[model samples]
Target: MTRHPSDAPTPPPAGTDNGPAVSREEFDALFATVRAWGRWSPADRGAWNRVTPDLVRRATALVRSGTVLPMARPWDTSPGPDNSRPALHYMSELGDLEAAEPSAHKDFIAVDYHGKAVSHLDALSHVAYRGQLYDGRTARDCVDAGGAHFGAVSALGPLVTRGVLLDLPAVLGCRWLTPGRAVHADDLVSAEQALGVTIGEGDAVLVRSGSLRRRREEGAWDPGAASAGLHVDAMPLLAGRGIALLGGDGDSDVRPSPVEGLHSPVHALALAAMGVPLLDNLDLEALSAAGAEEGRYAFLLVVAPLHIPGGTGSPVTPVAVL
Candidate 1:
C-alpha cells in the first residue's frame, strides 16, 4: 500500500527540519545543551544508572504471556556493500578428526560489528564528539589502539528493565518508512498516543522504522549512506524523559544527515554527550509483529554483552520479553 506524504508525521522543529541543512552553530548549541558531561561524576555507566532494582522488578512483572523474542540480526557472513567485513564462522574440529578420541564438533565465529551488517551494542566509548567521551573523558587518554580504558562495554554489565517499542509504520498505518525519512519528537509522541504507551525513565526505547521489512521486500540498500531513524531534534525529548538506552533498525541517525559537517549527529549526542549506549542494527521486524499482536508496546528488555574487559563494545544478542 502506498502512503501519501500527507500521512507522514509532522516534521521536526525549526532549524532541525529535514528539508534544509542544519547550520553548525545550531547543531553546536543543541549538542552543548544536551551534553551530560560531569553529570554522572566518575560514573561510567552513563544513562544506565537510571535503571534501579525497582524498575527491573516492575519490568519483570510485565511479562504476561511469557513471550520471548531475540532482537539480534543473524551473524552475517556474506560480503556485500552493506557488509564490508562479513563475520567469520568455521569448523575448528569435526567429528571425523583422527586425533579426537570420540566424535567431537567445534566451530568459531568473529566479527567487526560496528557497521551496517551485524547487530551490536555501541558502548559510550564507541563514539567520541569533539575529542571527548562520556563524563568528560578524553579520547586520547582513555581509548587507544589497545581498547577503551573508560566506559567499556564491561562497565554496563547486564541490563534488565522495561523496553518500549515505538512502531512508526504500524502507528502511521504504513508498511514502512522510506530511507532518508526522519523521525522527530512529534513522531514519537504521536506513536505513544496512538499505541497507548508512554516512554518513561529507565526505559529502553526501540524505534522501528520497518527497515528490515523494507530490506526484505525491496532488497538491501546502503544504510550508511541513507536510512530512516531519529533526528537530532528528538534526542532532547528522550533525554528529558531520562531514557537509559536507545536503539533502532538503522544506527539511530537519519541520513544523509541534516546536520552540517556531522555524519551521525544523533550517535554523537546519544553516546558521547548523553552517555547512552546504543543497540544498533536490531531486527525489530519480529518485535513489531508481537507488539501489534498483543496491543502493548512495553515489555521486559534483557541485554547481556560478552564480558570483554577493556573492550570498546560487544556483539550482543538482546532479548525482549512480552
Candidate 2:
C-alpha cells in the first residue's frame, strides 16, 4: 500500500485579508506588556506553576467516559514536503544473533523533533527572542552547545491539567481552515460561546484548525511556508486568560507572518514573553470528534516528556481523557 503525502491546500496570497500588519515597535510593546518575568519562584516552569494541587484534582474530576485520546501524529519516517528530515526508524537486531540464548528483535528510532512534522512540546528555552529567554535569562548565558542550563524540558517534568479544545473548523462550519488563515481573539471568544467552554488559568488550550484533516484529504504542502494558526493578535487574550500551555495542529503561528521581520511572533509571545510552553503539530482530529460527540470540550490532559535533563524539549504523545 502506498501512503499519500500530508495535506496542504493552495494558500491565499500574502497581504490578502490575513489581518492587520503589525510593526516592530508595536510588537515590542506587546511583548513587554505580556512578559511574565520574575513571577514564579522556579522561573523555568513558567506559567505551569499555576497548575496547583487543587487544579490537578479538579482536572482529574473532568474524566467521565474514561475515553482516552492520544494526540501525537505518527512518527513520520517517509520524506515529503512536510517532513523534510524524515524521522529514522529501523531494526537494529533481527533476532538472528547466534550467541544469544533466546532470539531478540530490537528497533531503533531517532528524530530531530523540533520541526513541522513532529508532535512535541516546546520548552521555555526552546525559543528566545531578542537574546532573552523567559524571566530575562540571556540566551547565551543559559543555553550552550551541550544543552540549556535554564528553562530546560526537565523543569517541566509532567504536566497534568484541564485542557480546552477550540475546534475552529467545527465552530465555523468548515471541514478545514485554509492555510494562511489566522485565528484572532474574536474567533476564540466566538468558539468559546459556540462550544460552551471557557478558557481558565492553568488550562492547556488546544486550538484545532483541521490542518491534518486537510492533509489527509488534500495533499502535502510546506507548512513552514504556509499554515493556518493563531495570529499575534490572539496572544493578548491568551495572556490575559493566564493559560498554562498553548498548542495546535500548526505551531500556533500563522505563516507569512503578519508582523514585519518576525516569522513567529506568537512563539515569542507565548514562550519568551509569557513564559508558557507550547505543544506543536498535534493531531487533534480524534479529540475534535470526541468533543463534538460528548458535547463537552474540556478534558483531563496528561503530558509526560522523556526526562532529558538538559534538553530543550521532547517529542511527546499527549493524552486527553474524557
Candidate 3:
C-alpha cells in the first residue's frame, strides 16, 4: 500500500456521539481502498493477506542483519513459590480447576497460562467496542463453557511480517516509562530515527515505553496507575500505513480511570473500529539494548497468538530475529 506522505492525525474519542459508528458501507469502502492500494489479490484475502511473502522477505532481511531478540517479559506469578499474582493464577489453571494433579505428574498435566512464555499475539476477538468484536463478531460469540468460541492458543496462525520497534524510552532518554505518559506521533518518528529504520505499511509496529522494566523491577505494573503509551495522535499514522498489529510492552500506555473508565484507547479504537490487532504486555528491554548496542534495527518478527476461538488476548512470546 502507498504510505501516506506523513502520519495521519489521531482519531476522535470513541464515546463521542457525533462520531457515529463506522457504517458497513464506510467499512467496506475503507477495506477496498486498502486492498486496491496494496495491489492485494482476492486469492490472498484471509486475515493473513496483510502479511504476504514480500513482507516476510523484508522482515527476514532485517532479522539477518543482526541478532534477533525475544521481546516478552517473563510472567512471574508466585513469590517464593507461595504468594502469586492473581492474574497469573487465573491464566494458569483458569481458577485452579486443575490443581488436584499429583506432584510428580503436575508438570505433565500443568496448563498454566501464566508462565514465562512467548510467541503469542492477541486476536481481534480479545477486545471490543460497544460490545462488538473484530469483523463485527459479537462478544457473545467468544465465550462458552466447553471452550472459547474460536478455540484457544491454536486458532491463531503464524503472524510473520515487518515488525518495527518504536523505542520511546530510548528516544526520550528515559530509564522508565510511567503510566499516563502520552507518546505522540513525533515520538514514534524519533524512535524510528534512533533505530535507523523507516516503518512501512502493514508493519506490526511494537511500541516500547519501558513500562515492562518497571514491572520487572517493582513486581507491580498496574495499568490503572502507570503512565505510558502512544497518544490518540499516533493512530492515523498507524492506520494510514495499514498497520496490521500494534504491539506494546504493557497492557496499555494510558492509565485506566475510575470514573470515566476506558479500558484502552489504542485497543478499542484500532482493533474494534479499524481492524488492527493489539499485542500488549510484551518484553522489549533486551531487544532495545541489543539494537542500541549494534546500531542496527530490523528483524523477522514472528508472533502466533493462541487460537482461542473467542478469547481476547493470549499470553505470547514475540521474537525479533535480526
Candidate 4:
C-alpha cells in the first residue's frame, strides 16, 4: 500500500484470506495522501474550504423550506471507564434568612469524561509526547501564576464550517457497530453514496458507528469489550481528503495505546502531529436519522469548544443544520 504523510504505523493490511494487518509502509503511504490534501495552517479554517457557495445556498434553502432539520441533543451524564469519572457533583451552601426560613443553594459541577456536554476543544498543549506539547511548547510554558495552560476550552474559538456525517453503520448493514470493529475508507465511500452526497476538502467528517447507542443502553463502559472506531489506516484517507476535523463516538479504534501505554494516540497524531482537531463522544443519532430521511449528507455544522485555557478536552454541543 502507498503511504501517506499522515498515516501512522498500523497492523498488516486486511486481506481476502485473513492475512496480517496493513504494513507500516503501506499505512504511511495512505496517510501521505491525506496530508497532501490538507491546508496546513493554525488558523481556524475548517471544512468550509471544501464547500461551495452553491451547497451552502442549497442547505440554507432546505432549512428555510423545512426540508432539512437541525439535530442537537441535550447533554446528560457522560460515560467513562467503569463510571470512574464523576459526571456531576454538587456543593451546597447554607445561609441564614435572619428570622425567615433557612435558605440554601447548590452548585452543580459536571465531569466530562463521557465526552458529551458543553466543553472546549483540546489544544495540543493538553497532551504531550516525551514531555513535549504542541509547537514544541512544554507544560511549564503553558502555566503561569494560575498553573493553567492552553488546554482550556476557552482557547478554541467558534469552529464554523460545512460538516458531513458519514453513516458507517448504515453502510455496514448494522444499527449498532460493535467495539473492535475497524471502519475502513471503503466504508466511508459507501456511506457517501448511500447519503447521496460527496465529501469534499476541508469538511469536518463525522464517522458514526452507532457505538454511542450501545454505550448508552449498557449504561457503563467495559474496558475489555471492543468498540467500533476508525481504523488507523483511515487517517491517511481523511488527511488525503483534506478533512479539517475527524470526530466520532469513541476514543479511537487502535489498540494497546501508542505512547508508552497511554491511550488516545489518535489525539496525539491528529492534534499534535497533524494539527487537526478531533471531536469525540458526539451524539449523531439525530443527525444520522435526519440525513437518512432527507437523503442528504451535507449540512451547516457548528461546534464551539469551551474556551477553557490549559485544558485537555471540553464537553461540546455540536449542531447540524440541514
Candidate 5:
C-alpha cells in the first residue's frame, strides 16, 4: 500500500542498525569538553554575542559584486516524509464584501517549521539536553507549554556577519552526499582549503551537502530520519572558532547520531552546550553556485527572524551577499 504524506511512517527498531552509534559514556565526555554554559554575559543571545559592529563592517567588506541570494525553501504547503506538518497558506480575505471601492487579497500563513522542510532559525531554547538550555538554565524553569521564557527568537533579532560556504559536494566532486553521511571536522578544513576560504572569528558557517538538490532530481525522503550533516566531532572546531551562527541544508547533525542516547546530539552540544543558535534546512544551491562562479566562498550573510515574543524559533529567510 502506498503511504500518504499525512501518514507518519512506522519508526524503525532502535539498535546499531537504526539508532545512534556512539555509547552514552563517549557522548557525555564530548559534551563536557565543549560546554560553554557561563561564557556569554547575556545568555539569551547565545553565541550570537560574538558578532560585533567591527565584525559586521568586516563582513560588509567581503561584498563586491552585490549579488544577493535568499536561502529559504519556498513556503512549503505540501506534506511529505520530511515535511510532517506542512506550512499553511490560504487567502483569508478576498476583499469583495469587506472592501468599499478597492479590493485586496490577504493571506494567512503558519508553519511548524523546525522540521526538515523549512529554512528557519533555532533559538537556544529550541533544544534542551539533560533538562537544561543554553547557559545551564533548567529547561523546566525556562520553557513551558506557554512558550520559552528565555532565549526566545525575539532576543535574536537581526544577525549580520561573515558567511562561509562549505560546498562539500563541490569539494568532493559529487552532486550530493548520500543521506546519512557524516561530515567530520577534517572535511571542514579540506573544504576551506579547496574553496580558497578561511573561517575566522564571528562567521556564520553555511555548509551545503546538496541534499536538497539531489531530492529535486531524485525524490523526497525523510531528512529528519537520515540526512548528511556535521557530526558532533565537527562542532568543537566551530565552537573553538567562535562562530556566531551555524547552518546547513540539514540541521547540522548527522544521523544516525554518532552519539547514542540522543537523536540530535549535535543540536544538544551546539545550542545547549556551546550556546550556538542554529540555522536549519536552508536551500544553499544558489549560494553554492554563486561561490563557484565568484571563486570565493566567504560573503556577507544576513538573517532576520520574525520578532515573535517568547517564541522558541522563527521561520527565516537568510540572505547571502557576494
Candidate 6:
C-alpha cells in the first residue's frame, strides 16, 4: 500500500512558526559557500580528518569528574506516531529448546534506521544534493544496492573528540523549545555565551532542544512535520566554525524546513556540502542535567560505529565523558 504524506499522523499541536522561507537559488549559493570539496585527501572521512591524535588527547583532558553519559536513545521497537517502522527484536535462539548443559539466550535485532525514531549516525554518503556527494563525487557512480563505495561509515571509523552541548532550553530558561520553532545562528552564539563554551574545529556540537523531554511528558508526534531544531541560516555559522560533527534531539533541521522543496536542508548542508556527519535523535536530557550540575558543557565525546565497509551509516551509542 502506498502511504501519502497526508496519510501520516498529524503533527503536534503548536503554532505554524518556521524559519524564513528560502529560495532554491539562495540555497545553492549557501551550499557553494559551505562546500569543502577537494579540501582533504581521503574525501570519505571528510571533516573527521581534522580530528588528529592531539585533538583526541585534548578532549580527554575535559574529563573532570569522569561522569559518563551515553547519548543514544533506547532501541525503539514499538510503533508510534514518531516511530513508524518499529525496530525488530526477536529471540533467534533459546538454550531451553536445545536442552543444553549451559544455557545461552540469543536474540536478533534489526532496524530500518535513518528516520526520526532511532538514534544513529549519518555518513557523508547519507545525503547528496543535485546528484553529487561530498567532494563533488557523483552519487550514482559511488552508491548502489551493495552500498556506498566512496563515503561509507567504515571510512569514518570511531570518532573521538570534544563535544559542545548547545542547550537551547537551558539558555532560554525554558523547559523546551516549542514545536515548529526555528533555532537560528544567533541562538547558537547566544548559547555559546550562556554556556561559556566555544565550538571549534574538530568538535562534535550537540544541540539540545529538550524534544525528548517533551515527548516523555507529552506524547509522540511526527518530528518531521514540527520539530524544534537548527534553521538553514545556521549552517554558515557552523561551517565557519569548522565543526566535524553535528547532532541534536531532533534530526537537526527546523521542521517545515525554511528552504523550499528541501526537507532536510541541514542534512544536505552538513553531509553533502560541509562533509560533516550528523548524529540524529540523541537523548540529550541526561547530558543536559549532568552539564547543568557540573556547570560545564564541554566533554570528551566518543562515537564508535560498527565497521560496515559498504554501509552508508550506523546506529551508535555516543558516550560523553565529563
**TM-score of each model, paired residue for residue:** 0.93, 0.95, 0.70, 0.71, 0.92, 0.95
lDDT: which candidate is best? Answer: 2
Give all candidates' CA lDDT scores: 0.86, 0.90, 0.57, 0.56, 0.84, 0.90
Worst 10 residues of 3 by lDDT: 1-10
Candidate 1 achieves a global lDDT of: 0.86
lDDT of 6 at 202: 94
Higher TM-score: candidate 3 or 5?
Answer: 5
* Model 5 Cα shift for residue 256 (angstroms): 1.4
Please identify model 5 stretches exceeding 4 Å from their true place. 1-20
Clashing pairs in 5: none
In model 6, which residue pairs have backbone atoms overlapping below 3 Å? Answer: none
List residue ranges in candidate 4 displaced over 4 A. 1-82, 91-106, 112-120, 135-152, 216-219, 223-225, 254-262
lDDT of 1 by residue, 126-192 (tens): 8888898888789899988888899999898999999999988877766677778888899999989
Question: Mind giving the per-residue lDDT tens digits that candidate 5 earns over 1-322?
Answer: 2111112222222211322366878888888988888887688998899999999999999989999999999999998898889999998988785657677889999888889899999999999988989888999999888899999999888999999999887777667777778888888999888888888888999888878887897799987678888887787798788888999998888877777668899899889998888999999988887777778889999999999888989999999999
lDDT of 2 at 6: 23
lDDT (Cα, 0-100) at 244 in candidate 3: 66
User: Which lDDT tens digits does candidate 2 get at residues 1-322?
Assistant: 1111122233335412557899999999999999999999799999999999999999999999999999999999999999999999999988777576788889999999998999999999999999999999999999999899999999999999999999887776667778888889999999999898999999999999889988887898999888888888899999999999999999999987999999999999999999999999999999988887788999999999989988999999999999
| Candidate 2 Cα errors over 4 Å, as ranges | 1-16
User: What CA root-mean-square deviation does each model show from the true structure?
Assistant: 3.8, 4.4, 9.2, 7.8, 6.8, 6.7
Query: Better model by lDDT, 3 or 6?
Result: 6
Question: Number of clashes in model 3?
Answer: 38
